[model samples]
Target: MKIAIIGCGNMGLAFARAFLKFDLVKKEDFLLVEKGEDRMEKLSSFQPGVITGVIGPQIGTYDLIILSVKPQDFPSVQEALRAVITPNQVVLSIMAGVTIANIQTVLDHKAVIRAMPNTPAMLGMGITAYTASPEVDMTQLRKVENLINATGRSVFLEEEEQLNAVTALSGSGPAYFFYVVKAMIEAGKKMGFEESVAALLVKQTMLGSFHLINTADKSLDELIKAVASKGGTTEAALKQFEAGNLDETLIGGILAAQMRSKELSKG
Candidate 1:
């Protein structure tokens, strides 16, 4: 199938690379659109035969269009696409707050799939949550799912509003993990390890912890209890976290992200 990707930014490039890596789309059948000349050059270097440019009359030739442009840039992209996008072409958007209805209104197209994916998609480990307009059938939805799954896992939502919660959780979740890892590395350094060694220690600890969580059948609270024996060092740290209300603060932050996501969609 002919596929066109607009923006060609980090997320776009990640998807492009994944598509090429998985042999999901031929290089000749792929189109990359980016306004920046430098980005076009980079894409050309990365995938030699893919076509790159702003949206034009030729856009109608593609069966699928993946919109990866920033939400702020949608107006300009929409205007450029107004004359070219046809009802038959499907649009799968990964812009954080751009809803399928918003895309439909802006581009005057019906088949739209809106998705939220995180930075981990660059490593093919991201989880994308998506919802589609009624105009998209199950066959088209499955195709979009396969394309998205090239980067990582994908889930479908019955209610579009749930995307706001997904945006708060997995969409911005990587940064939360990184924030804690940064603190852990600093704590290691304060305990007398070198900077590089501290980073290594914290990184491996995180990886091992994730592995344990994935492989074990125990619930998260049970796993925590397994490590935090009464009156032990783990318990001591747990007390500190509880005293600081860390859980409440984290939940509040995620809710704030969801609120911001809703506001962005409105804009």
Candidate 2:
């Protein structure tokens, strides 16, 4: 499929690299529109696609167009995009807080798909949640799904509103995981381990725990029970977490993120 990506930032390049790595789109068939001179120079470092400084009528020829610019930059992009975009072409937007309905309305076009993807997509281990307008047919949906899967895994939501929940949960999830890991490492350092040693220990433990979560037949509660034997050290940590309402705090923070996402979407 002929694909055009309007921005060449990290997330955009992540998708571009994945598509090229998987042979999903040829370098010749791919087009990159980036306005930054330095970014354009950097784009030349790797042969991802045909690079251009601006969007033009040539954009109309592509089967799919990916909008990866910042939410605030869409107005300028929309004016140019709307003029040349054909009705049959599909637009996939990865810009945060930008809704599919708004894209369709702004461009006076249909068949728009909006997706929320995390930073892990750079490593091809990301999870993306997407929603599409009714005008996107089954074939186009499947094609877009296949392209998204190249970055990792993807889920299609029937309601676009759910993307905000996804944005809160998975899109911003890595930072939460990192925060917990940092705390664990700090605790290890207080107990006498060097910073590097503490980091290695905590990182390995987290990695192993993740593998167990995937491979073990036990439920999360059961797994916690297995580690926190009655009156053990794990039980002490669990008690402290409960006392501080850590779980509730984490949930509240995610809800706040969703609320803010909703607020941004309205603007």
Candidate 3:
């Protein structure tokens, strides 16, 4: 089936590359709708057979149209799509905060899907959470699932509103990890390691720690206990974290992210 990706930005090109990797769509069958000449030219070189241009009547030939534009660009994009959408098409959106209902109000397509794909998708190892309108057929749902899974994992949230929490968690979760890693690197450097050494150490610590969690059946608290032997270095750090209410501080930050997610819906 032919797939058209609107707004050929990072997420768009990443999705395109993943789809191409899995042979879900060939270069010729894909159309990239982008506004800038430079970006269009760049994507053309990446996949020569794919077509790139502003959305128009000629581009309405796609069976599935994926929206990858930013939220603020939606109004003008809606105007552009109003006349071009046909019932023969399905719409998949990766734009945050803009709901499936909002998309329907603009593009007027019954088969709409909204997905939350995070930053790590650039490396094809991100996680995406998505849900679709009831109008979407099983085949279309599977196709979209495959598309989201092309990069990494996919979670199907039964209730559409759960996307707000998904956005709060996974969507913003990477930045949180980066914040911790940055602090760890700085701490290492302050302790006498060079910048490069600190980075290597912190990166592997974060990576290895997560890998252990993924492999182990132990609870996080149990894992902490395992690392913190009676009066060891890990215990000292844990004591400091407890004294500073680190867990409560973390919860507050996550709650702030959730609130921001809801706030974006108002925009």
Best by lDDT: 2
Q: Kindly list the per-residue Cα lDDT of model 2 for residues 1-267, writing each as its tens digit.
A: 999999888889899999999999999999999998999899889979899998899999999999998888889798889889998999999988888888999999989999999889988899999989989999999999999999999998999999999999999898899999999999999999999999999999999999999999999999999999899999999999999999999999999999988987997
RMSD of each: 1.3, 1.5, 1.7
Ranking by lDDT: 2, 1, 3
Q: By TM-score, how accurate is candidate 2?
A: 0.95
Candidate 2: which stretches are off by over 4 Å? none
Worst 10 residues of 1 by lDDT: 45-54
Q: In lDDT terms, how accurate is model 1?
A: 0.90
Could you give the candidate ranking by TM-score, starting with the highest? 1, 2, 3
Give candidate 3 regions above 4 Å deviation: 48-51
Clashing pairs in 1: none
Tens-place lDDT per residue, model 1, 70-184, is 8898888988897899889999998888888888988889999999998889889989999999999999999889989988998989999999999999999999999999999
Better of 1 and 2 by TM-score: 1
Considering summed lDDT, which 10 consecutive residues are worst modelled in model 2? Answer: 94-103
What are the clashing pairs of model 2? none
